[model samples]
Target: MGQTSKKRGVGLEHWLVPQWPAPNTVFAYVTTRIGGVSKAPYDSFNLGLHVDDDADAVQHNRAQLSQCLPIDASPQWLTQVHGNCVIDALDDGVVREGDAAYIDKPGLAAAVMTADCLPVFFASKSGARVAVAHAGWRGLLDGVLENTLKRFPDAPQEICVWLGPAIGQCHFEVGGEVRDAFLQASTSKQGVAQAFRPSDTEGKFFADLYQLATLRLKAYGVCSIHGGGYCTYCDEERFYSFRRESRTGRFASVIGLLS
Candidate 1:
């Protein structure tokens, strides 16, 4: 576990927390908009490589994040496509085009990048493995969380989850189609239908992403969960919000095992 603080020079502030009883199993934390070397839009401390930021600057920022982690455990980066596909990080083949990554192997890290999209982290209570998922509305509708839960060998009750910052309900306005998609997927779950409420603007509705995620997790029997209070679109200074800035940079959420 680590601690959160604002460091000068870098221009980025980071949040750190420990996974207590499971001390040996390193969990997840996110990077804020403050530190890094990218200019304008990207500002500082942007870790996204594919976002049109100067490659060299992105590389430098990534290096800074690496320095913060233990020397033995290198962070594993992924090519996210907002799909439910989950791959094993231990495989050294070409980067898989998917939304999630997991690993039971010690010293291997699993990470996902996001702006307003949810970054959900998972760890077995027994400390056997960990995973991270990028859950945008598309991915969520496609069953990303359910797919990731299936990756764990243990029962869903043994899995612990942490839902990272994302667009909150008040700021997450969606069309009727989006709400219908969730209602369709949550067929057996009766209360899911109410997660969407009509927005003040016509033809739009306020979608509670956090509530949807909780419903999905509970459906799968994963009840030990935490986090999911912040809203990226609402807090521009702390996080990068694609909805707020179409050309903005992305932040990262990382988790791995301690060697």
Candidate 2:
């Protein structure tokens, strides 16, 4: 199983895929800074093409990832501007500006980049559809998850979601504006910031992105949410963290139907 180790939140191994009730035909996985050709900083296995890592090295890393895919295809990468735009995974020739990609057809993989931003994976109940979202605070506030969900025919509860590794509340310090944005995103403006607490520094808060996202999904009646609690900032060997180290590489969370 090129998925994950039984000891979930430990060192970086091969892959860090979600293990839940998604249909057997649905394929979803995340990459770590291991098992590839990248050198120091990126270390190894860095798949993002936009980062400053060597293009040849990234190609090599991605080629390694392509070998692990159940299908003989590469993931459809996006320019992810931390916006709400969602596109079809099939639309991947030139890198488009989008935060998410939905793929209904088998063999096409949808992926999003992240060093600290959350990577959200989606799969329809019957495995007819799969998608991946890049959810930085800006994207989440602007409804990237909402946009991605709308691309599928199923309702919120009919889809299964997995929240991948990201900067946790413990280390994710944010300004008041970030909190206000989430409050504005929520219709009720109630308890949306409950996960956010006043930081030791004035006018700052420790925002819980996972809580904020789960709250939004629950509002839309999404129930089968899994994964989270692994902090990228804390897991030095297992993940790359932009907040912790600026010149780091991005990993990916990908999803698609296995052909």
> Best candidate per lDDT, number?
2
lDDT at 245, model 2: 86
Query: What's the CA RMSD for each of the models?
Result: 3.7, 4.3
lDDT tens readout by residue for model 2, 1-259: 2333222222234788697789988878888887777887888778777778999999877767666777766778788788899988873456667999988887678778898899999989978898899998888888888888988899888999999999999999999988987887687576776978999899999989898889877877889999989899999887889999888888888887776
Question: Candidate 1 residues 1-259, lDDT tens each?
Answer: 3332322323323553533334355645688877778898998778888889998998898767766654344577889988899988853535567899888877677668899999898888888788899999899888999999999997998888888889998899999889877777776546776788899888889888888888889888998888887899998877899999988888888887765
lDDT of 1: 0.80
C-alpha lDDT values of all predictions: 0.80, 0.83
Least accurate 10 contiguous residues by lDDT in model 2: 3-12
Which runs in model 1 stand beyond 4 Å of their true positions? 1-13, 16-23, 91-94, 188-190
Error of 1 at 10 (Å): 7.1
Pairs with steric clashes in candidate 1: 10-35, 11-34, 11-35, 12-34, 12-35, 35-44, 35-45, 36-45
